[model samples]
Target: MTTSRPFADIDTWVFDLDNTLYPHHVNLWQQVDVRIGEFVGAFLKISAEEARVIQKDYYRRYGTTMRGMMTEHGVLADDYLAYVHQIDHSPLQPNPAMGAAIARLPGRKLILTNGSTDHADKVLQRLGISAHFEAVFDIIAAELEPKPAPRTYQKFLDLHQVDPTKAAMFEDLARNLVVPHQLGMTTVLVVPDGSKEVVREDWELEGRGAAHVDHVTDDLTGFLQGLSKAS
Candidate 1:
């Protein structure tokens, strides 16, 4: 909940690659979940269903299922990423409207994602908008530090030479955006249509402090349009 308008002057736009760029209802995560279950089953010598339960537990405890698997089960990161991303991407179609919106945005645009660079490349290629971003900061760039961690955000800004004051973070996850807000960067929550259930507004508000939310919009294009008008 922001009291005042914070979109007065923004020079750089940092975007999250996954659900933020595209709608989650597209069911890409379902594929990833299936892969995770399969990997867990094979690694732990358990049923897929049991593996699913263990995967959830790991995610809850270690922030990521892979992290838990690495620490507890001694799984390799490369193997995990390879198995998880082995899915059909034909369902993803090009979002020309999104591409147009990215083209209209003012200043540098970069992607900051917890996913792998190869996956990011595949998604961008599928969306037909790889040219929209100047650079992409994926999981490799973060050095395995996932979102909601202050250090990850700090490292991202440091690596990209981004000024917190001039940059805005556009993410679908409220927790991830919370850190950038704390660092004096404007935060925009991209809530796609029909995906309101996934956006945890209450959790975001609960943690709101110096790093407060600035805007919440259902459509990224409309939000950027409003910013253009405000500017």
Candidate 2:
């Protein structure tokens, strides 16, 4: 179903970086995941497989793996971030098409991500699209309040001085899109085909009376094309 909300009225577009900005098959995050598993293994004296399971459990329980480690294992956030993002980002090449799309998008644009500011900066720089966003709301800005949390969505709106009704949130994670919908923002789910790492939470799809997502597209290019036509 299409939304009655006019696309022309959207004054701000909040984008989720990382997986949303690029295809997960690129395996950029897999490198980071390998490092995370290594860290968990070395620090906790567990096998790599065990570490992976623990990381997943922590992410589910604490909204973020870092938060879980910090609270439960007393791991320092800075150290964890430094260790995990230490890999080479040479795999991420600039996407001129993505940059062009961002350039053509109307109104204010900002990046909202659960990653650290340093990581966000590096990723955007690697993509050669750092100039597109006006501001970046990183994990520090979220104050450890990760996505899927209503308070995190509220904090994003408050920090940007945005009217929730007039904003649009584009995220790869269906769960993260829920709170934005609840807060009256137009929600778009970017569902790229064959993205194995895209986590699916049944609650996001099965819950009754949930947030009414405005649109779903396989990639940013299609979404941008549709918006351009609508405009």
- The candidate that wins on TM-score is 2
TM-score per candidate: 0.87, 0.89
Candidate 2 Cα errors over 4 Å, as ranges: 4-6, 195-211
Please give, for residues 122-196, the per-residue lDDT of candidate 1 as tens digits: 999998999989988977687776776688888989998999988999887677776788788888876647644
- For each candidate in the order shown, give its overall lDDT on alpha carbons: 0.79, 0.79
Model 2 residue 54 CA deviation in Å: 0.6
Model 2 lDDT per residue over 1-231, tens place: 366655677889899987678775566777877888898888899999999988878877777778888888999877888898887788889988888877788889999998888888888999999998999998889887688778888888898899988888988677787788878888887764654554444433333223466777667866776776677
The local lDDT score (0 to 100) that residue 108 gets in candidate 2 is 91
Worst 10 residues of 1 by lDDT: 199-208
Candidate 2 steric clashes: 0
